[model samples]
Target: MDVAVAGGQTATTSHQLDPLQRGLLTVFRSLPRTAESVPGRPTPLVLDVGDVVVLVSGTDRGSPATRDAVLDLATDAGVVVLDDLPGRTPTGRVSLVLATHHTAATAAQHVAVRCRAPVLLPDGRCVTPGPLRLWVRPEPTLTLTRPDGRQDVVLHDLHLRDVADPDDEHPAVVDVFAHPSGSGLLLGMTDGGAGATVALSTGPRCVRVPAPTTATLDGVTRTIAPGTYRIDLAHPPLYRLHAESAARPETG
Candidate 1:
């Protein structure tokens, strides 16, 4: 990890510190000398997930001076700085502690100077709880090769839950884009058994087209309206032509 030290010196080094110690120092530095009173003693500091500790002379009259001293110590320690607080009870207190990467032992020393509370730091090593190897299923790739050597490929993917229930029905998905020359083509795919339909709002109301047996399908045509249109590919899917002009001329 990268270590940022005082005097603007930064270096890559491996070192460890105690988490509890860090927390203690943070608490010591942040504790206010005097605040609204509790029943008999001062209000105790509450430690949360990410807190750092620093040590200050408990008898110090001013909180600002103590905090500054703690900041200076942190700068010299070559560890990242954070906030701290005093723990409950009259005897001693714990400070909050945190680190940029992981907890370390140096924090323990800082905590020891201030409070009698035990120092705690997270283990330096990172432990991945769950499966290290991700369950990444490959996306389905579809390739269409025409007799004339023209070909196209489409990639399709669905979430595991979407296909988990074998009985649930789903609509096919189709996309059609038009060229500047008043011509367009259609590309889409559906579930293994699901069919689809196509349509255009301006020219053709509904066109019936059968879904391919595989996961992906594509078709090319030179006769489609230039205006925008919506292609529907619901169940019982079929492709139809509402207007004769919108249909592609049958080629030999």
Candidate 2:
């Protein structure tokens, strides 16, 4: 089926647009944009148009910061997000909605979308946005005092200031590696240090794809040997998927 999809085309009179075209233009142009635009370039927009004819409107010609998408799409076929879309993200590193599930369309992924983590969109193409999960690092902590420039995925940020003896505090150093069982964050494990890192949070933690030796994360893919990269979820609470299922639309 042919479905009209308009992102940003403005400065047009009413006479030039049909009822549907005009409606789309109004939804596309009237909504706020967060990304900066160049005269000869593009801007990415994310809008959460009120629950009307649409749900989410992402990667349009407006702004990059808008958290909600306000566009409507009706298609029986599939939609693909090309690699070029990522380049238009907002300044400073930020998460961009590459794809999403729509009632009228079907989306499938060969990599990142399948595992529900943010990985490189192979060949610059996005799969089913429905399955793409946002995996945030536990805020990598680094100190320059050490010669190695030791970095850590801070599972816990609050270092007991006055509660514990100053000398007995855990340094919060972490060493990540692979676990044959699954893709989950392994906490309470010691890094050969006096103290161990732990998780007291609710969200599921991420495990190195395959193992730490084959490092690839943060939307950045590394060229490594096969059988070395596999994404896993760790310590995922039961309520996470419960809430996730409620938010996602059901498809036949």
Write one digit per residue (lDDT tens) for candidate 1, span 186-252: 3323344455333222222222223221212223222322222222222111111010111235999
- Which residue segments of model 1 deviate by more than 4 Å? 1-92, 98-104, 130-252
Report the lDDT tens digits of candidate 2 across residue range 83-161: 3222132223322222222210111111122222222111111111222222122212111111132221221121111
TM-score (C-alpha) between model 1 and the true structure: 0.16
| Candidate that scores best on TM-score | 2
